[model samples]
Target: MTSPENAPASRGPVVWYAALAVVMLLGVVAVVAARSSSNTVSNKVATAQTSKVKTGSSSKALPQLMDGKADAAIGQIIPAVSGKTLDGDAITIGPDGTSKVVVFVAHWCPHCQAEVPKIVGHLKDSPMPVGVKLLTVSTNVVKERGNYPPKAWLDRVGWTAPVMADSTDNAAATAYGLTSFPYFVVADAEGKVVTRVTGEISMDTFDQLVKAAETGKAPS
Candidate 1:
């Protein structure tokens, strides 16, 4: 055997290279671990962002309204419908101790076109009484339909009521049991449905309905 100091120079270099190889292997493992941790953090942040998003009008759908049918939805609490407006503002129709006359209209309906201007003029002449609010839902929107953009139509008519922009699926209209354009649902201060009528209604009839809702009484 060679003396200790006479060990092969090649042997020394081999030992040094072995040690460097082990260190390089350890460094690679550390980098992999760091990358995995970062990816996990990024995935968690994405999940949290997705969970906070709110889409459409309501979390749960309400019972469908069957107007003029036996066992109608009258005397039932209206569902709390939430949606955004034409101006991207949030709005909700709920039991807030305020009487509400909610009307559902489609931009493509001729009756709605005729009815909206009349209602607008009526409201301008005699505003809703205190604690009674008038609200409109723009629903069944189709870009190819007449009056493509409802905001422009309502603005042209000088409508001042709070207008809720219904979802692509007509969530607001469906919640209110809308079967036809110019549908109307009157709710009392306690959020109970006073009356619901379909088709265009005259201002005199509309006034009566509002009175009934404000007093929590059905029209006789």
Candidate 2:
């Protein structure tokens, strides 16, 4: 028979063992929960990144030119224009002994948004000819507009052309006499303006403009 004092002592070890088991079980549960939560967060992050990549992937549709016409500025010397790129590199435009195709785009223009992907796709599929430098001028950036920030929009479209970020006053656009979005200006190796297209143009028109710029003549 156990004494009254022995009863408490006998129960003490059992209680301690049960308490320890409970604590261990809780610890294991907590660790498992934490790992599960971590995995969930990681999966969400991966899914978001994949979605962004898929959304920005290149399209296969060909582009078409519209309302294209030769400019009066044709045969005139292109202005010595300069601006910074999205990566903060200084870019100067003019006669650099190479034909240049300058594409002026606005972030807020729906037409520009539609045209950009097509241009990128066409350029990727069929690269520009040698001695032809393709450039883009990101202008008219407005926060409350169609695409919001211009830099992100360009990145989203996977624009790989040399970009010249226009100033707050749109100095580059003004220098080129831009009256509309998605404008195209082609200049010869000698910096002479060959032609200007006011709207989106097809790849054939793009090639024609480049050829015209190189030969110092407007596209027929």
Best by lDDT: 1
C-alpha RMSD by candidate, in order: 19.2, 16.3
lDDT of each residue in 86-124, candidate 2, tens digit only: 667767766678888889898889889988899888878
Model 2 TM-score, all chains together? 0.67
Residue-level lDDT for 76 in candidate 1: 77
TM-score, every prediction: 0.71, 0.67
After superposition, which runs of candidate 1 have C-alpha atoms over 4 Å from their true positions?
1-68
Q: Residue 118, candidate 1: how far off, in angstroms?
A: 0.3
List model 1 lDDT by residue over 73-135, tens digit each.
688777777767776677887667899999888888999999999998998888899989999
State residue 60's C-alpha deviation in candidate 1, in Å: 7.1
Top candidate, metric TM-score: 1
In candidate 2, where is summed lDDT lowest over 10 consecutive residues? 47-56
**Model 2 residue pairs with clashes:** 65-201, 65-202
